[model samples]
Target chain A: MNMREYRLGVSHGLPVGMGYFSVSFGFGAMAVSQGLKVWEATLISLTNLTSAGQFAGLTVIVAGATILEMILTQLIINSRYALMSLALSQRMGQRIGVFPRILIAFFNTDEIFALAMARHEPLTVPYLLGLGTLPILGWTGGTLCGALAGSVLPVSIRNALGVMLYGMFIAIVVPPAKREREILAAVGLALVCSSLFAWLPVLQKVSAGISIVLCTLVSACICAAVFPVKEEAAV
Target chain B: MNILLYILAMALTTYLIRVLPLTIFRKPIRSRYLRSVLYYVPYTCLTAMTFPAILSSTTSLVSGAAALAVAVFLAYRGKSLIVVALSSSAAVLAAEAVMRLAGLL
Candidate 1:
């Protein structure tokens, strides 16, 4: 039974696992280039598949941002995972034991969520197990390989891989935004607001950490206010 | 102070972000506001992380970002993921060469 379930999990997670491998390859190489050891970079992928968090955290590490800064930055950047987990719990068909859930939570990333949601059936613990495990393993493994090849690949090649991260973000946002006018509006609103801060001198000084929180909250709030999702009375 | 301790500390702190919320919100999160918040948070975080470093990597800000933008456009227009990744990355490489030759960046 366990064997079959494990196989099932791997089947469901192949796309995510492979995608993470590519993405984290760049991340691993970058981390090493930025002076983290290969082991440290690989460990980052193992512990946190939260790409944005790691990228942001790398900045803090490079800049030697204070402990308080790291805490606050990570909290704001990663707050959405709390939401992802909430949605995931509702979808998880099997009840999760605390220890297992803790382990799974560590690797709950966008690729995994997209892969899991693409499935027809509601989630099972084994399925969630697949979603979490394979991708992270792929990520860690890719990072190791990338870190090893860091020097031979050259900086231009490395810099080019950085665009993969950007491509991923645009790929994530543009599709849904195209379909839903509201989502598109929220994105446009954020782009405008953020860009304004970009062009404006005073606002540019506002921390990126704070800017993300404010922009997301304000943009999302405005959208919600304009086009509220009606919750029918639960009879 | 040591590297192992540093890795462990950062790792623990990073884990705590995802951990604390699941612990508190053990049950289903049905809050509409919160769900809406979740939908947009990752993008904001991505932008925050990526924007600062992207421009300085090359001389011309527009070309590198534009190449990626074109790839994204093609992707949204229904190109395959591989197409998007390769073409966009190709765009960046191509653009840098052009910008350097043109001396516009």
Candidate 2:
């Protein structure tokens, strides 16, 4: 294992883990309030590792929805991960074997995926594993704490903590966008598309997951056609 | 209802969606256009998720917008991820405090 890359991954993952803690804290509190056991909530976090999909799944479970409904909901909400994984497949270095790929896929979340993609070098197994560890712990651990404590945190603190992940997202995207005109244009196009989905009466009916997928597809396609990355730079 | 069964099903479904692509597409993609799309996907996806959603993420629109402004400024100036993230959260806390003091929240 490359110790340097592992440490680098761990350091980069710290903020992601911290952000996951607050979000999963809210998730745990919500699950318990809806009558789930603390362990059960933690188990969901341990196994799922997805924010939106888990939340939606919890709603389905609480509503006594059919397993088919649960499957469909998770399939749709978490489908974007498939896209992320596809992109990530090309980024993986030769060191990432099938076993590591299987393991890494479990935690191929939005934040981690973004961080890995932003790396100029191909992804290594050690780095990916190091990155996944804290997030899994934070997610499960925070859920346990939240389920047990159930909103012991003050409202003001919780409110401030809510935007932590989005802040990280902006931080990841903005620097790259600033450096590349094509990326900047893609970001702008995505913003406009997402805004329309959020606000337009007709588009408002689209689910958040589908809206994100569509916005990303539209923006990425336009940028790719208009300004395909030079072959040398793509590698 | 078997809750564990539901959890298992949800977990399995989500995992399959993620794992299939990674395991199947081990070889590098050769298409330049496809590679370009992949390159742009992360930025576009993250951007779509952040905006509009970030505005509603906090207690009030004012605090949320404050966080966005702070985050964008710091990020544009090439701040590190941790710095930008913490500053944005701090911005939210500070904005909410000011709003509370002014009876706007």
Candidate 3:
């Protein structure tokens, strides 16, 4: 593995690390609010790298959910990683072995997946590992600090920071959405779908995890059919 | 112990989802429709997660809207994600403090 490739990966991961830090801070606060100790909150972030899955699973834990319930919730919430991994698998070099694949898969969060997939060159094992390292540290470290300081943070400040994650999401989508009419329409469709599921009585009964999956799948399929983007147009 | 088990289960389940596809699928997916769906997954999922929930994440609706507006503008202007996130959060903090002082929250 060339040092240059690994360094390149780290450089690319810097922004992702920063984003993960803030988002996991919010998760840490949420976990603390749900009655977990700081160490427990950090442990959750360490083991589960997903924001939505960790939040949803923690809610189930707070509710005294059954193990089966927890499993189902996590499976549904985290199923998107399967798609990301599948897409990334095609990008990896054919010679990559099992151990690196296993290690790379463990740290494959949404941001990492998006960043890796955007690359035009084939993804290498060392580069993938390098890319995964800082974001994992940032995620775990942020959770640790936030969990430890959860009580010290005032409620208003915590509430204010609440918008940071959503802001990051907007930052991610808006630039691309502005450049691509198809992406903009898909985003709008997904937004409308989620709002419907949230407000409609029967649909509202569905779990948040399931609602997200349903909305994403339905909107994605409809968007693909109505506005299939050309290869060059996709980024 | 039960809590530990829950964490372990979650980790295991999440890891399996990530690994299964990465290990098993060596070739690129061939289906056009499937490719399109996969292509749009990130945008759709991120959008779905962002909206509706974002409306209620802040201390007040006005604060949330204000933060979102700032975020979109900064993002459009090509500010980095970290800058956009922090600046919008700062905006919300300011809006929240003002609202609280004015008894609007």
Native contacts conserved, per model: 0.32, 0.81, 0.75
Residue A149 in model 3: lDDT: 72
Regions more than 4 Å wrong, model 3:
A1-12, A55-80, A114-124, A229-235, B1-6
- Candidate lDDT scores, in order, read 0.66, 0.82, 0.80
Across A14-40, the per-residue lDDT of candidate 1 in tens digits comes to 877787777777677677777888888
After aligning candidate 1 to the native by TM-score, how far in Å is the CA of A178 from where it should be? 0.6
lDDT of 2: 0.82
What is candidate 2's lDDT per residue for A18-49, written digit by digit as tens?
Answer: 87886687678667766799899999999999
Instruction: Please tell me which model should have the higher TM-score, number 1 or number 2.
Output: 1
DockQ-sorted candidate list, best first: 3, 2, 1
- lDDT of candidate 1 at residue B18, scale 0 to 100: 62
Residue A31, candidate 3: alpha-carbon lDDT: 73
lDDT (Cα, tens digit) per residue for candidate 1, span B33-73: 65555565555445444444455444467756765568558
Off by over 4 Å in 1: A118-122, A230-235, B1-10, B20-24, B47-53, B80-82, B99-105
Top candidate on DockQ is 3
Best by TM-score: 3
DockQ-wise, the better of 2 and 3 is 3
Count of steric clashes across candidates, in order: 0, 0, 0
Clashing pairs in 3: none
